[model samples]
Target chain A: MGWISDFLLLNDPTLRVVVPGVLLLCGMSAAVGCFTFLRKKSLIGDAVSHSVLPGICIAFILNGEKNIFYFLLGAMISGLASVLIIDYLTKSRFARNDTAIALMLSVFFGLGIVLLTYIQHQGNASQAGLDSFLFGKAASLNKDDLMIFGISSLLIFLLIAFLLRGFSLVSFDDSFAMSIGFPVVWLKSLLSVLTVWSIATGIQAVGVVLMAALLIAPALAARMWTNSIIKMLLLAGIFGMLSGYSGAFVSYALPQMPTGPWIVVMASVIAFGSLLLAPRKGLFSQIIERNNNEKKILQENILKIFYHIDEKSGETQKAVLQEDLLNQRSFSNRNMRKGLRILERKNYLSNHLGAWSLTSSGRVEAKRIVRLHRLWELYLQEYLHLDPDHVHDDAEAMEHVITPEIEAQLDVLLGNPTIDPHQTQIPSKDE
Target chain B: MNSNDLWIVFTAIAVALICALPGCFLVLRRMAMVGDAISHAVLPGIVIAYLLSGSRNTMYILPGAAAAGMLVTVLIEWLQKRLRVQSDASIGLVYTLLFAIGVILVTAFTAQTDLDQECVLYGEIAYVPFDMMSIVDGGFSAPRQLWIASGLLTVLIIVITLGYRGLYLSTFDPGYATAIGISVVFWHYILMSMVSLAAVVSFESVGAVLVVALLTGPPAIASLFAKRLPLMLLLACVFGVLACVFGYLIASFLNASISGSIAVVIGVLYAFSLVIKKIFF
Candidate 1:
């Protein structure tokens, strides 16, 4: 609690500088990252981050001072150069996109390292803090750095906010944007510039090695929760800001911990959590949905089996033994018993000793399933010119899926028929 | 040249050769970034292994780093296949997460040790000549990194020579390979494992970034000249060795990081090849 108050109150001078710097950096990077993610160019962010090292080193070597503005300019230039080279290499027949990306990333970073070691050997006093750009020194940021970051982040944010429509259009379908008379090329170049700008600015907070995570993780996590670009941008920003805050706090509490890795770890945790747990598209939820659908199909299949048995014997409510149900289909014994128990619990079936019979409501529901199956089979036979034997398997699959509206349409399309293509009496809806 | 210079060049050539061998297959399969990913992700495996074994022996660290590399490939596959994440995003996500964890582990526990974060990115290749291992009692000795690298290279060359057909078939036409009863999945994993091994072996001298440079740069440059697989592999190795020699020379002249100079030289060579292709071909 004491630490929490200290963190929240920003009692420490270092915390005051680091906390806002990280939040602004991460939030803007994430907001820009969504477009890159949508364009399926997320790895380009990684390449740009790595490529900025040489730019920073060159800026230092030339300026002979630790000017933040010159570093950003140099980083942005090299970052853009790397991106353009990757694009050209990918377009060429020789190298693939992945190869081009890896080539540019390692080579540029290597050059940066070369210059960096050279600078170290020269013993330049100002070159002491340049290596911090490699791994980030968030706590070392001063008021002037914060002012620069705040202004740049605000400009990028407002720019994105104003051109949201064109940006989304270019990301989703550039050709369509072009056809609609939008300046596709200009918009694309602007987007690339924005991407490089964000990476160059954010690199100092998270370092060259882990900067891509700040761009990608929040956007990816936000993507899992949304389909709209606006919502994704907002969610990604919030997620980024949250990770930034927590990462700064943790590094503050434990002075030994590095801030950049902690920030990446927090963002990754959020992204992985979203991937595994978000609704509908999430892995766990999809698995659960699939399991429930299978169970429903199994239960309906059991009901259809009972209805078929009743139809043959001309006894609407006759009880059937478990063996009778098992003999009709190839269902395993465990699944059959499980389905029967579940059906009975739902009052769809009444278990009498060792036998089971459909209840009144269950018979009605069972009748509808059978009717849909027969209707689909007849429709496939009459309209598709298929043999009666070929229609049953297809209808068997569709029977559990057809909604009531589709059932009526099929009934009307089939001319309210009472006889199926196999010359069996179709179950009437009212009955 | 002095013995130190000779020994450094030898180590660099060995590392470049080892990385370029598996790197050809990675490039052919268009999975070069996976090599990049594994190179970074092996860090945590290294730290955890060091913690458990409490030794810097290759016996402990190699397997740990190799295992970590395999985990990265498997996780990327799972994310792509099962979770339906796009391939690039998944690669970016998994490697960065693992790398972040590695950085954390290094800072938290290994701060007192020799394995610092900077060393992980930019390895101490120039210092390789100093860490000698005596093969005989008061007789012959060699740098420890050279012995480890040479042993790994021998193993790698033998594996590639023995498994050439399977590797060839799997990379070129996986469906046809499967039709002929060759297990595509098995060969894919085998190649990935070899890549992991190469990355781990090279991690000491060149560090992760330069390992990627060696892995991708040589093969990419070679593909412009060679069409056949064997020729491509030979050319890749040749270019890799050349890069090593030139990089070492440049590093000595500039008094800079050896691995970094090698990477820059590889880039220069790649550009040179591109220019050659434009003029001659």
Candidate 2:
């Protein structure tokens, strides 16, 4: 508690303003971003960012200073105009989406640069504040800016909460929404306007170049965890808050370090962590499961070897020579030893002359693994229309992992195929 | 208009016509930003030429600017092909870096007396009326930029018109053109160079920023109305000349900062054109 008080006293004004303000802005913007990401309109955020520059510049010139509301309104117009023009061109001509996006981004930024330079040459000191919009200077926030951020965030939050169902339906399947009389056009336009509003609000603090990342990264990071829309929104909000707060803190701890880039770095950290370690879909989890399953398969195969020898002679199969076991099947010596030890520990096999025979449970497990392998091959070849040569490889991988429910679905889909594509009979569970 | 004024107008339009001719072809290839890039990127070349000659010889300056323009094209193309950056991003990155480097070098190295960043960005089209076109026998009558711009424009038009079909096929679908044995890459370089040359000659007049407007806006506006490439080229040239005239008039009337205002006006005009298209369509 003393340390917390000391920390608050040290950063005095930062805690009151810049830090909280950025958190509010990044949070609201990222929530909006997740919707845009799902809608496949990510780089349109790029267009909005660049296009808003001229709006802000024009608004600054018109208002003779940084009047946030006027600047935001003016920016919203250009943002709408940019989207509408690109929309028109793409609709009317031979323009690819990338071309329209790239074109609008350059021309608008060029025009703004030209205007900005001209204004600078004119030597208006108020316009001096306009340079912050180029690369952003979030550390300079005051109470007024924070108030604007607070109100804007409140409004956006309300807008999202009130329209949650409509938004979800619109984002996931707009064509279906339209069929069901959801006024898709209005919803899209509303989203575009909100996007522009957030961009306009952000430009003075975080600038334009990094604003798109703020709009996209949090949601992208959140997406790695779950497919459920409600969870996605909540996780994205949390990630956004983490990035925003930590970025502000780092920038605070080290004087003169830019806030926006740190925010991006933190957000990317979360995105990368989720990419490699999220459950069910994370790289590490998948790799670990695959390793464990392979180990189980190896043990089962060794048990099968012991069972094969035991069934052949009916007495003292373990005393047979290892050479005889090698001739019976193409098992390597190292794998044969590992499998024999596992079976022996479980009391399923005794390798006296390196000829192993399985106990009852080991024989049953081996039969199940072989049955699954052949069943999947049957499913793929019959139901998937895959050729025999192609079916074997996929079946070979999926056989160890397919659950009973999946197998039941496969049975229903393939109508209980009795034979594999290679003319081998598929052993049923009962058999 | 007086007969002398008429003759000047004829010459000016004649020169502009040659320039506008190439502008048409460039407008089609969609290497419009290359013109903008070259126009700005030629400053180092000009500065270098002035350094070498210790004077602004049209001969030295033109080639110098052309060389610099070509260098920019090469840099942008290399960035595009080798790095696999998108052509648009490459254009933005290359031009900004070159323009900034030129500005910084000019400030850092030399006495801060002569040209500065604004002069480079805005150019001095207003003073073209003062530049004398001199020869051994012929007295200085015409502005030399007009003559050079017109001459280069003529060469550009002749080449483009001769290779117009090949160029059109290449622009519309390079894969199809390659299948048909067109040297798509060669024509692309030729087209890029022509834009570079056009930009070099016009660099002093329209300025660096507005040159982008001329190249992109006219073609884009022309495109809104025309379906055929030839018609689009013609309309683009007409729009280019109209923008110059109206831009000149508006700059004169407002007594505003001429070059910057002209660019703003062109932007406004492009927006108006978009609105018109939307309403009518």
Candidate 3:
């Protein structure tokens, strides 16, 4: 509690404003970043962030001081100019988008560095902290800066809310939005404007170097947990806020640490966590699903083996020997034992004296599987004109995935074929 | 020009030339951002090397940074291939995270060394002449950065000369190259190694930010004017030298950072070429 209180810097009046200001700035960046991430224009945010540096430097030079309004205006103009230039370069077929981004980012940032160096060379005291814009100076953010962050963040949220339909449509499908008369160009430009504005305003908190991380990481993390755009936006905003707060907390506790990089580090942690640990799209879930799928395929293959053996032996052998089953298809001892246990538990098979025989229910299920397989093979052979031999491999893969609806369609398409391409009898459903 | 001015100009040109060679391939493969990613991500490697070796040996720094460069590549591949993250998003994610880690490390160890964050971002190119390393007992000496830059530039020229056709073939069409018994992956790592080498060497003199300008800016300008690969490579060196000269002049007149001025000059040259190309074609 003592450290926390001290970190909030409650003794300093100016420090009171920095927290919410950072929260607002980061939240807005995350919100805007969602659209950029979805649009596959993450690097554009990077270019805009770098482009705004010269704008800040130029504003300082013009005013001989740090006027937030001039900084905003200059940054907005140059940021938009970078966007336009990139669009022009790509659209003109002169350079690819990546090329344009790298080109503009380096060029604009290089110019910014020049101006910043010039400012420093002039030995102006006001320009002393200006270089902090490269890596951000969140602790020094004053009340006026907070006001700008607050109002800009509010405006960004409001515009996103009001124009949700237009923005989503444009981001997802611009040509369709245009065909439906949604002023696609204007909406895209508006999105670009919003992106530039968020980056330009948020520069003081995260800086040009890691601003792209703030824009990208939270949105990417949010996307992992939800599929809905609105939910993603809300989640990204929350993630952004958490990152900002935690980052501020760290930088406050450790005076040597910069807030911008800490914020980025926090956001990346959240993103990596989400990627590896989320329930649906996460690595763990995907791994579990893959394992389950492999198990199901194995079980299905075991069932097919039983049906083939029973059919070939003409039901004369009530109990097939384990040795016979092993001779027909390869299954390891442990796997065979486990498969038997699963079959026995499901009432799909009965083992008597170390020999396996299918139960009545199991026989019916096995027949259905064999029927679908042969039907697909026949369908492929007849309609697609594939060689009977060639159809087996594809049908083998398709059998497990064929839905009940697809099975019925295949049945109708095959015209109730009684046998497969190899002339094996396709068991009837009533068998 | 005075000897001091000559050293500065020579260092800039050498750095620019080294970067421009490999940068041509990056631009062609549409992987310019990879160059940016590697440059940013190599910070931790350099820092880690410095921390471990407790010295600024080229042997330690270059290899360490190269390992970090490869880590960036591997991390980006994992995110894109395994995690299913979007390509650009992955690039953005990995570099920033590594760079942030580097920033924290650099800050934590500020008392132990003179390698501050500002120096990494905006290098003291103007002070390069002062940090001279004597070759002939101070009678004929060059900036240490100049020596490293020239050495790396020599290695770059040798490798490019030997592997030019292979790099060109694989970059243009990997599948066809592989069909013809060329190893695309070999060329990829080789190019990446070169990128890391250039990034680490140039960063000491020009800083990470302006080094990126040198890597991408000159090649970008050459790409605009030249269609053939040889011509592009040739023109990139020419543009790089031109940008260095003009940038030096501009910095002197304006009393600005030399590296920053070089970047600005690169931008101006690009715009000028853009206009000329647009008008003539």
Candidate 4:
């Protein structure tokens, strides 16, 4: 409790400076990241981040002192240059976009490394902290740096709020935006500028290499929770701030831990967490949904097999042995037994000794499935002009999926057909 | 040049040749960023291997890092194919996460050891000449990195030579290759494994960034000039060697980082290749 209050109350001066600065940087980058992500230029953010290294080095050389403003100015310039170079290379047919991006990223970072080593050898006292940009020095950010971050983040937020529609339009459908007489090119440039600015400001916290993660992970995590662009932006910002706060807290508590990687690790944990546990789009939910769907299909398929067996024997509600059911359709013995027990529990089937027969409710349900299957086969044969043999496999898949409304529409479309293309009697709803 | 210079350049050339071979296939497949991802993802493997072995032995570290590289490839594939995540985002997410964990591990556990974050990002290639290993009771001595790099180069050359046709067919016309009973997925993973091996081996000498530069840079320049696969492979090796020589010279002249200078040289050569294409071709 003491530690929690100490942290939340900002008792430490370093925490007071680091916390707001990191939160602003992460939140803004995450918001801007959604645009780059929607534009399918996520890797471009990576290229831009790597490209800023040389600019920082060059800025240090020119300014002869570590001024955050000049460092950011140089970073934005080089970052934008890298983006333009990638765009040109992609457009020039010289290389594919990925190739161009990879090339630009390595070349710029390499140049930065060269310059960084060059400055290192020069033995300037102020150059001592420049290497910090490589991995970041978030714990060392001063009050001036926080003010810069606060101003830059506020500026980015306002620009995004004002041009939200245009940015989204360009991101989702640039050509459509162009067709509708929007300033597509300007909007794209504005978005890139915003991305570069956010990245330049944020890299001081997370460093150049992992800055792309800060940009991409929060947006990706937030995307799992919402569909609207505005909601995605807001949620991404929140996720970014949460990760930033936690990363700062952990690093502060444990003095030896580096702040940047921890921040990235926290953001990734949140992103992967959302990926696994989000309600609709998460992997866990998706797997569960798929399992349920497969179960429903399997149940419907088992019901259809029972109807087929009854039709073959020219009897209704005849008790069939387990072996007899297995002979009709090759299901795993385990799945067959489990499916049989489930059907019995639902009152769709009744088991007497080892033999099973469909109940009245089960008969009606089974008849509807067979009707849908034959009706689809007839519809495909008549309307699609598919071969009669090909129609059976097609209907087998559609029977489990066609809903009642679609079934009625298919009935009217097929015009009350009693016989399928295979000349089998099609069961009607009345029967 | 002195023996020290000769050893450094030779070691760099070995690293370059090994990277360029698999890199050509990566460039052909348009998976340059995957190469980048593998390079960064090998970090944790190197750290964990160092911790387990209690030494910076290449024997232990190479397999660990190579396995880490393969994990990145598999994770990216799973994310894209299974979860329907976008390709670039998956690559970004997986590598950065692995790299972050790697960085944290390096800072936390390996603080007392020689393995530092600086070496992981941009390695100390200049010190390669000093880390000597004497075989046969001090009868013969050479840099251990040179030995490992040369051995890996030989293995890579043999593998690439033997599997050229399969790689060629699968890379150029994967659909047709699959139709003709070539397992595209099999060849894809095999190529990814080769890339992992190359990246891990080169990582010790040139670090991760320069590893990416060597992997994608030479092949990219080679493809601009050569029309055929064999020619492209040969040209990529040639360009990689040239970049090593020139980069070493420049680094020595400026007293800068050898790997960094090599990357810059590669960038220069690529620009020159583009200019020649523009003017003459």
Top candidate (DockQ): 1
Residue lDDT tens for model 1, A37-99: 989899999999999999998998899999999999999999999999998998877689999
Off by over 4 Å in 3: A5-15, A316-326, A330-354, A359-361, B134-140
Model 2 chain A worst lDDT window (10 residues): A94-103
Instruction: Tell me how far the alpha carbon of residue B99 in candidate 3 is from the true structure, in angstroms, after superposition.
Output: 1.3
Compare the candidates by lDDT and give the number of the best one: 1
Top-down lDDT ranking: 1, 4, 3, 2
Tens-place lDDT digits, model 3, residues B138-216: 4868898898889999999999999988999999999999999999999998998899899888887788767778888
Of candidates 4 and 2, the better by DockQ = 4
Q: Residue B51's C-alpha lDDT in candidate 1?
A: 88
Clashing pairs for model 2 are A306-A356, A306-A357, A306-A358
| Model 3, global lDDT | 0.88
Q: How far is candidate 3 from the true structure (C-alpha RMSD, Å)?
A: 2.3
Name the Cα RMSD for model 4.
1.8
lDDT of 1: 0.92
* Native contact share for candidate 2: 0.03
What's candidate 2's DockQ score?
Answer: 0.07
Q: Which stretches of candidate 4 lie over 4 Å from their true place?
A: A309-316
Q: Give all TM-scores, in the order shown.
A: 0.99, 0.61, 0.95, 0.96
**Which residue pairs collide in model 3, if any?**
none
* lDDT (tens digit, per residue) of candidate 4 on A1-431: 68778889999888899999999999999999999888878999999999999999999999999999999999999999999989988899888898889988988998898899999999988789898898889999999999999898889989998999999999999899999999998999999999999999999999999999998999999999999999999999999999999999988888799899999999999999999999989999999999888777777778888898889889999899999888888889988887888888999999898789999999999999999999999999899999999998888899988999999899899888899988889998995
lDDT of 4 at B267: 89
The ten-residue window of minimal lDDT in model 3 chain B covers B132-141
TM-score ranking, high to low? 1, 4, 3, 2
